[model samples]
Target: MEALVDHVKTLAKSCDAKTRREILDQLQSLCHSIESPDDTVQRISFLNLQLAGLRIGADLKLFNILSESSSPLTIDQISKNTKENAVLLGIHRTLEHSYTLYQEVDKDAFTANNVCKTLATIGAQAAIHHYFDAMGPGIQELPDLLKDTQYADPEDITNTGIQRAWKTDLSLFLWFQEQPEELSHFQHYLTMNRSGRPIFLDVYPVLEKTETNMDPERALFVDVRGGTSHDIQEWKPWHKDFIQPQTAKGAKFYYMRNIMYDWPDDKCRLNLKHLIDAMGPDSFILIDEMVLPNSGVHWQMAQLDMLMMAVLAARERTHEQWSKLLESAGLKINNIYTYADTLKDSIIEAVPL
Candidate 1:
């Protein structure tokens, strides 16, 4: 264990990208070797507590309290400062190992780490609010929902995990419509997810490579069901004159980012058919989503796929699944462009048959 720890220290100082990858793989192996079955079971059992604590900390402004301070603060000081009860303050202290969301500098003193600083941002806080306050209870009730007859096979978005958890027949959009204030919070959550991760524009440079000399008046971008147009602004650096242009027939590419994973296969097929109808024979539909593998799944992507199941009765697709999905809609895969080293983000380019 000491040797592994020392090796990690050495690898941290090495600037080579390949060396970094080696270090991560070695660390993962070392971690598994040291971790006992009991430890693993305990961690899994306490996961719900960890998630609840994170939401609680966000609500209590615990991160903010530590972030604004010059040094680590005692739990009492934090409680006193926030005018929160001491018992409530104890929840966050236990989450020190969850993520570097918070750090325990001493036995009972705490401070914010870089990850915790992100929670201090307005957008992240809004996301926390939407997730915990609006969506949490329903997510927690997923097991009971699965047992219920009405939601036994929640394939449709209307009769989904969210509906079962919330004990409502209303779809997610309709629920948000009734609670307009929640609508903005939910929209903010979407923005936080879209902006916090990798930018798809950078992954596909073809937009800039091809759009530079094209006619400005011709529609180069169409944001179908685009909310707030944040992505359009991000795309503008590549094509400055992109102004919600016309038909998918004339457009070189039809782009959909982080959209398909929210719905099941049927809904995805329906949406794909629309994109196929809009496309010319040569035009492509670019889907930005995680494409999972058949085996040795990465934990983050796997958890996300599971959460999609629990929350929306949806899933992240595998390459074979994506190919089949596209084929069902009369589309064929042209090429897949992956960003970073993870399966969490990829661009699936498909053309109408």
Candidate 2:
């Protein structure tokens, strides 16, 4: 193993990007072979340290301070300029070992690295605040909430782990409305996370090809339960008509993006039923969501699935599960346009029977 690792290092110095990626895969497999139970336990137990350090660093604007500086700054200089305690700034040292966000330059000075630049961004900062301050407690209560008799399975939206942690029966959306800053940050997080990805219009381009004979006055897209239509406005600048309906009405296409995963099976069925009822014989519902794999779920997908379970009493679904849900709502899936690589999210096109 040591000789193989040395060979990999030698290749890494001159390998092409594709070969380097292959080398990384080999290295990861080799590393996994040697990993032990204690290593796993230790890694899991120290997750709080990483999050806690990030929370403190974000609160103190440490990433910005480091990223903007021309050169490395000492702890004393950083503390004096930011007006935050020097000891609290030391918390970022925890991030260096695993995240590669910061690097020590001289003996006591530090500089920002590549990942730190991302952390310094406004959207990333907002996501950090939302996760640490708004959603942290909710995540911490998972064990206790799952054990409680009243929340056994906790499938109901009102009786969720989030409700237990937050001490409110209000739905997650309603709760977000009351927390303005958190809501804004949450929106920014979504935009930042989804940035650089192609919209459904870019991927399918079916709208451009499929001739629409509907009245020009009708909405081009109906973002059901979409709040304020910010994404719609940003995505569709020329055609800005959006409809949020509670009843059946036919349109050319109905696009639902990242909404259904916040609901359980029963509620999802009801929502789909409404969309199904509103569909013309030629109408299609393009549902955007992460379809979890049957086995060996990716880390991001697994984390998101558990997050939905904890916060919304909802879940991400597999392809089979999505098919089952669509069938339950009297709809059949026509096509699934999946993004390239590891992105689990897909555009599932369905039609009413």
Candidate 3:
């Protein structure tokens, strides 16, 4: 095992991006191999403080301050810098003790390490904000959401997890729109996380590969907004409600990303109806989202599937599933251009049937 560890360390020093991920997966598998069932339970149950601690640390600019400091900081210095009391910042200390993301020069003193510096980045902070603040509270209600539905797959967007948690009937996006800052958090989160993901345009040549009737419809692309505020209006120009796209007919493209996956088939069909109503024969509805394979699903996507269920009573669709949903919704899929080999984020182009 020592030899194996040394080998992994050697491989890690020279491994490419793909190999690094494989090593990570292998490490996880190895971790599970050594754990007893009770250890597994304890790990899951006792780790609830991780998100809260990390997010609270980020909230107080703990990572930012630590990463920027010239040397290790005592708890007193950190508390003074953050305008927060040391007792309250103990959560941040607990996080460091568990994760070792910071260098502990002495008791109650810490300095930023590589992992801590990464967390200090704007992108990482955005991710922690979205997952912990925006989604965590509602995700805790997943058991109740499942229990109330009698363990069946969820159907309605109006009665989903977030709705139940917030005690509101508005859909997730609509509810976020009503909030002052949450909507911005979600948008910033998406912007940061989209950095390395697959892009449909990289693979699909809209003109050469479209292979559709290019008549009557003038060429125009409409990008739907997930949750937009004036802060993000500059990030995108075409800001339309996702639930009610209100697009111009005869437009060449009506593109939506990561929208369909957050909906049940029935609700997705209803939402697609809006696009179909406004689509010409030459027009296409481009759904850019993950199409999970029936087998060998990545944990990232699998966890997202759970997240959709936990949050919005939605499930990420497989290829056959996507086909079935779209065909039933009155759209004929022309082609599916999958850009990412790992996560299978793809562009499913279809025309009104």
Best by TM-score: 2
lDDT of 1 by residue, 112-193 (tens): 8887888887678887778777777767877776777555545766765677666788877678888787778778777777
Extract clashing residue pairs from model 3.
none
Worst 10 residues of 3 by lDDT: 228-237
List TM-scores for all candidates, in order: 0.81, 0.85, 0.84
What is each predicted model's overall lDDT from 0 to 1? 0.71, 0.75, 0.79
Worst 10 residues of 1 by lDDT: 237-246
Model 3, range 1-353, lDDT digits (tens) per residue? 89989999899889876688789898999899999999899878866678778887888898999999999999999999999978877766876668777888898898999889988988788788888876887888888878877888877777777887888888787798898687777767777777665567778786673556655445466676444433224334365676685566766777787778877887688778888888766777888889899888889989999988877778998888888898898887888898876678888988866
Residue range 239-332, candidate 2, lDDT tens digits = 2122333443666677777788888888888777777777776778889778777786666678888888888888888888899989988998
lDDT for residue 97 in candidate 2, whole number 0-100: 35
Evaluation by lDDT, superior candidate among 1 and 2: 2
